[model samples]
Target: MLLLLIPGVGLAIAVGILFGWRWVFAPILGWAMLTWLLGSLRALGKDAKPPGAPADDVVATPVGTDQRTLFWCEECGTEVLLLVRGTNRAPSHCGQRMHERTEILN
Candidate 1:
């Protein structure tokens, strides 16, 4: 997997084998620092969002008493019904958040 190249256990093992155990950490830490720097720069240059990530603008609000609410996942269209609670923490489904859609209950 591509994750094996992420300068973790594999690198540690290779460094420990090829060099000495003491020298192993030198490349590991160097790899970590280099990856962190490069990752930051790559993130700064990105315009497209990673898939299935939650929206940053969403904020949870408390639900009203004597009412019920429906929440739906925008990504997967999964729906949930809940009695109004003191506070609302929107539900999650399929790795995405479910948001409330207001409609008259009467």
Candidate 2:
């Protein structure tokens, strides 16, 4: 999709020049700008930034607000809380141990 942008603009400009009509540049430039903005938005969503200190205060809750368990991998320093279903094997990270994470009720 990124590769297509160049040819799209080039073709638009070429047709405009060949036909001796400069008005075609408006739509072509508009389309190019739209695609550029779309690409930027997509790139922004792809890169996930690490959470700051506020993440520690997050409480994981499922639909209906049932009392769900939270288990996180102690190996990772920024491990996220997990919701427990049935009794299953504990999660791990980087060959390190996993521990249950609890939140203090404020």
Candidate 3:
């Protein structure tokens, strides 16, 4: 889709030069800018939330020695062993925060 912009710009330049219609570039450039802005917004939205994942506001507290806590990512089968962290925020993977799973080792 971005490759199409090159031809659009070239065509705009050609029209402006041949017919002295300089105003044609305005709409073309505006379209390009709008496309870029929308694309960036979509990227941010995707990075903000992954499918079937809860919000990031939930904080996980540290567990005892007998209990183990795992931060798991649903998007990609990734597991992280959270141990002795000062922060309450959960670990993140694949742009989203991992879900917490507690297990008893005893």
Best candidate according to TM-score: 3
Ten consecutive residues with minimal summed lDDT in candidate 2? 53-62
Candidate 1 lDDT by residue in tens digits, 34-103: 9999998897667445789664653333555444578898887888876534344577698766888765
Clash counts per candidate, in order, are 0, 0, 0
lDDT of 3 at 59: 46
lDDT of each: 0.71, 0.63, 0.78
TM-scores of the candidates are 0.37, 0.28, 0.41
lDDT of 3 by residue, 1-106 (tens): 8999999878878988888775796776898999999999998896465778765454454555678888899999899987655456677899888898888888
For model 1, the stretches where C-alpha displacement exceeds 4 angstroms are 1-67, 84-86
| Alpha carbon RMSD to native, model 3 | 8.9
TM-score, candidate 2, is 0.28
lDDT comparing candidate 1 with the true structure: 0.71
Backbone clash pairs for candidate 1 read none
The candidate, 2 or 3, that scores higher on TM-score is: 3
RMSD of each: 11.6, 12.6, 8.9
Winning candidate number (lDDT)? 3
